[model samples]
Target: MGGGNTAEQAREVLMDAAEHLFVTRGYRASTMEVIAREAGYSRTAIYRQFANRDELVAAMVQRTTQRHMVSILSRIPAGAGPVDLLVESLVIVASELVSDPLLNTIADQTADGTIASLIANDSGLTELVKSTVETVVADGTPFRPGLHPNDLAQFIIATALSFLMKTVPAVTDPAVARSYIETFILPAILQESPEPRRVF
Candidate 1:
């Protein structure tokens, strides 16, 4: 039992190390040997856990995505308003994508298909977003006319990601990013007369 636990802990460490390296350096620049060295593991040990760099990268992406979902769900307030919940969720997602090294690495990768597959396979995140959207719509805060809650949820998630990818590298100031979301993005998303804005 102790050996199994140790192996699991080592795998987690390797994944965390790989994620950091992959994000700081592009996929091509990150090698299994480099990951092993950074993780303080032997090349053979890394191979025993992960077949290759590609597998390690995939695992890291999946693990990070899972953690983000768990964090978001845990932070959501009980009995909160749907639209409010959705906005908070978006903020959380955006913050995580901006700060998480594993996600940064995956976003930088040119292989869109692989990234899409990773997201699609991760149902927990999608389901949480979908359920939150549905709750908001059902709670009388209907989405913009003609926009399905499901589609809107998807758009919100995708747009938040795209915005982060495009803006984070260019803007050094955190306030600018927050301002853009407040002054532009939020208004565009909320079609109602009284535009929704973050209260706090």
Candidate 2:
């Protein structure tokens, strides 16, 4: 089954080509013109799809995050507890950020601070990831009741990057990583340690 590539399809094709070029060369090297030529499209067509190089990079990030999240969510074991789910999600993200070809390429090729600034400036990414995770998990799956989903989602993103940057040895042992997250991170962030009621 084949048909002419629609605008959406063309945009995806451009992203794919950009990802390859970024991996082989680098983010700075994979210019819009290069991407356009790689995708077999004109610069005008690339402009129609993305206003600028930043927009193209953002689109690639969004697509990768969505695809990776869906893949990770689909594999969660049934009856996994809240802490387990969060831990699993973070673990998968960390692993993929370092190992996945697309994400790893971005990490390696992008100039220092480029990805960080992109993440910080993307205000909607937290909500997007949180909502996507909620929609995918079964109802009543028991995410941390007290922690805001936004913070949790953002923390996952931040922590994953930290792990990638640090090359955390804990990640080498899945069981160790899970234990540490459950024992420390989950309790610290998710536990509803309410302030004791002040008695006047």
Candidate 3:
């Protein structure tokens, strides 16, 4: 048990260094050696914790994403209706991704569409959003006919990533972003309830 705790602590220290290096020096430039040195550990120590740079980066990204999701979920009201919860979650995610320092650094540095690929694949961010979406709709929330929760989650993740990547015209304005989600996105997934719930 003590050894497990020590290992986990070492991994956290390495990840903290990786985050700083990846944000400041850019992802490709922050090699494992430099990350180890930055974390005050020998180069070989990093290998003990992580098989390769990719695994280390993945760990850092997963940690950061989990932290981000915690912040997102906390800001959302506990009593929010299903539509409101989903809309608010998507809006908050888009807002944060646009301004996220590490993600911005990575996106700015990548030339081979790495960020786009991450979105398309079931990466950490996608899985996090999918899990949230499933939770939101778990109470038998009605959707467009025949659309599964997983499909809706994927669509929402794609839309949020598109906003982050600015693949479409930039919805920089919050009002415009909320409107876009409410108008185009909500109607597609959410059934037209007679109650007309306000998603604001």
- Highest lDDT model number: 3
- Greater TM-score among 1 and 3 belongs to 3
Inter-residue clash pairs, candidate 1: none
The lDDT of each candidate is 0.62, 0.68, 0.71
| Superposition error at 143 for model 3 (Å) | 2.3
Q: Mind sharing the TM-score for model 3? A: 0.79
Name the better of 1 and 2 by TM-score: 2
Q: Give the TM-score of candidate 2.
A: 0.78
Candidate 3: C-alpha lDDT: 0.71
What overall lDDT, based on C-alpha atoms, would model 2 receive against the true structure?
Answer: 0.68
In terms of lDDT, the poorest run of 10 residues in model 3 is 191-200
Residue-wise C-alpha lDDT for candidate 1, range 91-185, written one tens digit per residue: 66555556665565545554445454445444555565667566567534635566676676677656656644654443324445454455555
Full ranking by lDDT:
3, 2, 1
Q: What does the lDDT read for residue 58 in candidate 3?
A: 62
Please give the distance, in angstroms, between residue 53's alpha carbon in candidate 1 and its true position after superposition.
Answer: 5.4
lDDT of 2 by residue, 93-187 (tens): 65555676666644543544656457535556666777855553444544455556666667766766665554566563566555555655665
